[model samples]
Target: MLDQNTSAQLKTLLERLESPIEIVATLNGSDKSDKIKELVTEVAALSPQVTARFDGTNKRAPSFGIAKVGEQPRVNFAGLPMGHEFTSLILALLQVSGYAPKVSDEVLAQIKGLNLTSDFDVFVSLSCHNCPDVVQALNLIAIYNPDTTATMIDGAFFQDEVEERKIMAVPMLFQNGEHIGQGRMTLEEIIAKLDTGAAAKDAEKLNAKESFDVLVIGGGPAGNTSAIYAARKGIKTGIVAERFGGQVMDTMDIENYTSIQKTQGPKFAAEMEAHVREYGVDIMNLQKVSSIKGADETANGLVEVTLENGAKLESKTVILSTGARWREMNVPGEKEYKTRGVAYCPHCDGPLFKGKRVAVIGGGNSGVEAAIDLAGIVEHVTLVEFDTKLRADQVLQDKLNSLPNTTVIMNALSTEVVGDGSQVTALKYKDRATDEEHTVELAGIFVQIGLLPNTDFLKDSPVELSKRGEIVINERNETNVKGVFAAGDCTTVPYKQIIIATGEGAKASLSAFDYIIRSGQ
Candidate 1:
């Protein structure tokens, strides 16, 4: 049901519709479908120009076909567009009603010049905040170019398509049936993909041994800084990463980055990318490292990095800066409700649940801190801890105790997430002491247990890793393996902040340079 305030806002926005837009929907009579239909009807009621037609007989549940009245329907919503995806739905309606997307003339010209047919099938969920950006960008391109078509497919509704593609993440892009990109991508990046058929065109499998003075294995803050520092020293530098921004791209607020009062993750990532690209470093984005061989194991007497795409590159020194990712609870409904309600990033998804009750699982520093931050925005917060007492600092516990809307539930084990087919509704847990099961009815659940280092790929290698899987590095960011260094959250660094990672990256690069000078290689 649309609130009074939201209904008024939608009514105001819908007045901008220049032409009549017909929304043809396919509903399977499910609860989610009924809700979607009601929502669409409510939007249609706001304006006589906007109307909706339903097809309840269609086998594909929770799907809708949208188009202008005179032209063919070129857009489809595979699931109910709620949460952040509602923006995409509204943008689609506006675009179909004859409003042009806000794209530059130069980009339009470049899009017009393309002879190839670009078909983009973007997989997204309703709760993903980053999906709308990618969808809107692609849809804008499609609107400007006759040869391009962009379709937003809801991952939850399109189970067959999702299973066939093995999509585990949102904002996954498929170009002409090939999985081209995943996660949030800029418009410039999509244009680049259109120009080059492959996601990592610059990282095509190398046939012969190509050596570099330094090779950075990740593209996070640490790896990018390492590459920039090494390139500034006039060395042959190369960086291979699954993604350019690493975990920093998922971060929403960055206040303690030194000097900067406030910044977001994506913006900081772009700045870092621009800074690194200013140097002569060869960067291979979206390339996953399959295995690595130390300098002694390589036949060419150089450390070798093998990519999942069968690319091989050798370097005198290798710096591993693969950052850490949020640890999953591995419980039922955790994976299914991901983004919809079971969110790992509090900063990124906190705003979506404003004024709604939510739970923060884990009573550690991150969990308690996230609870404190969310209590101010949300109606109420339930902090659940598995331990007998909160493991956070005393100061943080005291701060949490002061929040009026915050409820601390100690010695509770989260069992599962309770939700309908469309969205999350509540969380199921059990008391550790009494073994009494309880359910907390809430709109969202933020999991802040801990982080796991992204060094599983190095397990087969000779790289020395702690029992917890973090790479062990010395003060100079030098790993036990000769000519191979590690830094950032992936390493056993004392601090995992951005500033510390940047400093460690610089130290690793300088150490590599010193080793090269001493070895005369």
Candidate 2:
């Protein structure tokens, strides 16, 4: 199954195995089963410590379990772990063979200390870039705790179960047969859900931290850049984020990032985080900021930021780079049918709607690209645009128009998402030119309108904001509030590109440092 270079790489990786490991598979005499057998046999041949057996009786055919030689398999793959899941398979192999995972010691301890016996089944599509994070997280949990088991189920291969469960999203997770989550989730998020006291303890620890010279509020490209620049100045720096990578995690392709020729979003985000780590910046992920108080509001005369968990962190200088998120339709039934039939990420959730009719809710580059991509997998695509003409580049518009399965509706306003109480059935829109309302029957709706700034927490603060809710900043990236600055998509920067955000972040960090030196704080 693996090519020459890939086999050589796997052989090199397998040299780190500390103990013997076994791949026990269950086959049912089918084409997929034969392929699985060949894959396992080839994998076993790579290392002397690895062995394969096809005598097991797992109900899921063409499936295999990876485990230490004599232990019960805690990590399982119900389908071919190729594509984005290839890394997950490799990690499972290494971790099960006694190689330590790269997670923190605290997180590792939490996983091993879980008192509950849980079974996690994650449904994923091969093309989804976000699926590997969820799969690898649960796989790590299973590796640490003997009572827990994680099984990765490829939705494309197991169509019957996906249909029965009415799954329309990738990385949909179920615990003990109950649907728990339906999107990308981190290992910390999963542990916080299982361990009820974790948040309280974490909050207490955060509250006890000493004040920082510079504290960044987000973990996107902007926030990471600011943190790194601040840390390099020999000052204490920290970053608290709801989730690292922010909107970048949802992006699919990025070719305009200067030196890099081409790269995926998640991979770029991972590399950004790794680079920030080299600067020794304290990073706290999966934490939400509830409010930000000016320097005068705190007794210590330092800027204060409060967390959703009631943890208050004090910093001399605060940099806000909260970033933005996908703009919602905000129409009737849109919220109710989210994940059921409505989705914002075409690259992540497109595979679930194969051979089905879908609608794209914009005419910009993102929407046009989504329509062009979905036309290949879905039966038909209806592109609805509020403007009179498409705003995408000429090349993209030409490609979209060439697709036979695509229909473009210009000067149409989306009114509502019509659903049958469970899933979307059609999209309601009105023709701007004729004032005629129309409905397009579809099984899925992909919203690619635009982005909304994540500045809700700063609404009541003293920082000035533009009419569009973006934080107002000067050329130096300084906000109106003293000792506070802003950058990235959340700020009044004309364009919201990753490179621009990164430059703004560096400028903001330098501006904050200058402010501190002038004030002698």
Top TM-score prediction, candidate number: 2
Question: What ranges in model 1 sit over 4 Å off?
Answer: 1-133, 143-209, 350-357, 372-380, 391-405, 418-426
When summed lDDT is taken over every stretch of 10 residues in candidate 1, the lowest stretch is: 198-207
**RMSD per prediction, one decimal?**
8.2, 1.2
TM-score of 2: 0.98
* Candidate 1: tens digits of C-alpha lDDT, residues 113-174: 65556777888867665677788877767766656667788766676666555554567788
Clash counts per candidate, in order, are 0, 0
Indicate which candidate wins on lDDT: 2
Per-residue lDDT, model 1, residue 430, is 92
Residues 224-295 of candidate 2: C-alpha lDDT, one tens digit per residue: 999999999999999999989988888889999999999988889999999999999999898999988888
Reference-based TM-score of each model? 0.69, 0.98
lDDT of 2 at 267: 86
